[model samples]
Target: MVLTVSDLAVARGGAPVLEGLSFSVAPGEALVLRGPNGIGKTTLLRTLAGLQPPIAGTVNFPEDTGAYASHADGIKAQLTVTENLAFWADVHGADLVDSVFEAFDLVDLRDRFAGTLSAGQKRRLGLARLGVIGRDVLFLDEPTVSLDGFSVKMFASWLRDTHLALGGIAVIATHIDLGLDAPELDLTPFKAAPDARGGSDEAFL
Candidate 1:
């Protein structure tokens, strides 16, 4: 299913940050969110992902076709690399594939405990979870955080060659270059009015 947003207005700290935003991401496509820091990229992504109510606008997409990945790894410290993927896969009724391990360069560490991994390694393991689930739409914020230059390329390659190739749609907010071929949506002009602050849930329409 295609993901579409129209005249979207989003808030941060109960104050509107971005508004009058419109965009669509078709299956097999990706869109990169680019703007200065505090330009509300995260807020926009959260709004699109339905994590929080938007001040106003419409977000259209099939229910349960999306997944959000924030900066946090969200991994279990006690589980091994393989075990971690197994857990998420089971939750989604999917299977752990070799590509997921190879994509994140976690093959050598398959038996390693997540708690003992370094920061970057842990980050890779966390991102590897995306491959475990079969979700078609990805809302990612700073997905490459803590990853080294090489690991970032691994992620970029996987995202392009595997994820997008298989008809997944991604809306990502990142400062670094993951080498994605997606269009960039700059949110600078969409900044909300200074007076666009708190309002009732009815305003979310």
Candidate 2:
């Protein structure tokens, strides 16, 4: 499947931040989003993931093919690592895939309560949710925050050797390079004018 964004415009706090942006991601491909902080990488990802409506243009992709992973860990602290993953898998109408534990290095902590895991572990669990669900397109923002160098490499390896290798598509907004050999889309030129399209309170963050 292909993911396409056409002349898209997105706003933060009712004021536009990005506009007239167009791009596409083919199967087995990933697009790295690059720009200074607050440059609307998150906004654009949200728009593409259908989390919010774009100010203009369109996002076209196959149905039920996208998953968005942001800073939010979405971990149920009360539950164990396995249970947390199981919950999300079920919610996405997918089986609790055992491979997720291996992918994110959660095997040793499977029985540990999510609330008790270290910050990096929690981050791993959150990211692992992406694998648990059977989606092919990923929209991720700062997926490596709190992760150590080794964990980051593990995540990168999973993306390159597993996800992309299996025909998955990803659009990630992260400063660190995952070495996926993917093309980059810098949002610098797509920055909107200071007086773009609104003066309301729906800021992009």
Candidate 3:
């Protein structure tokens, strides 16, 4: 499947952040979003994930083929790791719980409550949702936030093997290196220039 974004403009709090951005991700390709903070990286991901409205342009991808994983680990504190993954797998119509658990190295913690896991463990559990969802395109926002060095490497390897290897697409917004040689979209040039309204003749008079 292909994910396409054309002439996209995104705004936050009624103020324009990015404009005229265009890009595409084909099967087995990964696009890494790189830029300093507050540069609309998150907004762009959210927009492409269909979580928010774009100020202009279009994002086209197959329905049910796109999955989004934000920085926050959306896990239920009271649920066990297995239960958590099972819930998402059911929601996404995926039946790969055992594979996902193995992929994230969560098999040992299958019966552990999410609330008892450490930050890194919880992050891993959260990321495991991607496998359970079984979508073709993944939108990851700072996926390595709470992961340890080894966990990061493991997740990166899984991404390369499962997603890219299987002809899936991924768009990741992260400051850390996932060790993948994906093309990058720096938001610096796409940043919207400040409005020029004050320079009008009426203001100068």
Q: Give lDDT tens digits, candidate 1, residues 40-107.
A: 99878877888888888899999998999998998999999999999999999999989888889999
CA lDDT of each prediction against the hidden true structure: 0.90, 0.90, 0.87
Q: Each candidate: how many clashes?
A: 0, 4, 0
What is the per-residue lDDT of model 3 for residues 87-161, given as tens digits with 9 covering 90 to 100?
998987779647788889898999999999999999999999988888999999999998999999999999999
Kindly provide the TM-score of model 2 when superposed on the true structure, using C-alpha atoms: 0.95
Among residues 3 or more apart in sequence or in different chains, the pairs in candidate 3 whose N, CA or C atoms overlap within 3 Å are none
Candidate 2 achieves a global lDDT of: 0.90
C-alpha RMSD by candidate, in order: 2.6, 1.5, 5.8
Model 3 score (lDDT): 0.87
Off by over 4 Å in 3: 196-205
lDDT of 2 by residue, 103-191 (tens): 89999998999999999999999999988888999999989999999999999999988899999999999999787899999999999
lDDT of 1 at 28: 92
Q: How far is candidate 3 from the true structure (C-alpha RMSD, Å)?
A: 5.8
Candidate with more favorable, higher TM-score: 1 or 3: 1
